[model samples]
Target: MAECLAIRSALSSALDLGIQFLSLKTDCQVLAKAISSKRTVVEVHGVISDIFFCISQLKGFTCSFILRAANVEVDTLAKAALASYLVIF
Candidate 1:
């Protein structure tokens, strides 16, 4: 669920900024697969729907899953934000 929200927020920002192309990277394999398949479990169907809608609006979009070690910087930042109870994009 957190992964879904984060991706949605990023996509929303890109749309707001008039970005025509986007490459999204995630360390969560399930989330990446869900997005690629355009399907979500019942618990997060709404959020996934929103993500799909955003993808439809984009001229080009790519969502990829990377190993945790490959995304250490973002992983650290996310942890820091959680520790501080802050929202990050």
Candidate 2:
């Protein structure tokens, strides 16, 4: 759910910035697969719906999964945000 919200928020920001192309990378394989398939399990259907809606606004977009080790920067930021009880963009 957090992954979906992050992706949706990022996409919304990109759209607001008039970005026509985007390549989103994440460490969550399940989320990546769900986004690529344009479907989600019932548990997160609402969030995925929002994600897909944001995706549809993009001219070009790609979502990919990277190993957690390769995403250390984001992981660190996420941990920091959690520690601070705040949300990271």
How big is the positional error of residue 42 in model 2, measured in Å on the Cα after superposition? 2.3
* Displacement of the residue 44 alpha carbon in candidate 2, Å: 1.9
Clashes of 1: 0
The digit string of per-residue lDDT tens for model 1 on 1-89 reads: 66666677778999999998999898989888888887876878998899999999999998899999899887666555455445433
Which stretches of candidate 1 lie above 4 Å from their native place?
76-89
TM-scores of the models, in the order given: 0.80, 0.80
How displaced is residue 82 in candidate 2, in Å?
A: 6.9
Q: lDDT for each of the candidates?
A: 0.81, 0.78
Q: Where is model 1 poorest over a 10-residue stretch in terms of lDDT?
A: 80-89
Each candidate structure's count of clashing pairs: 0, 0
Against the true structure, candidate 1 reaches a TM-score of: 0.80
For candidate 1, the per-residue lDDT at 79 reads 58
lDDT of 2 by residue, 40-88 (tens): 7687798788888888888898989999999988766645544544543
Candidate 2, superposed: residue stretches over 4 Å from native:
78-89
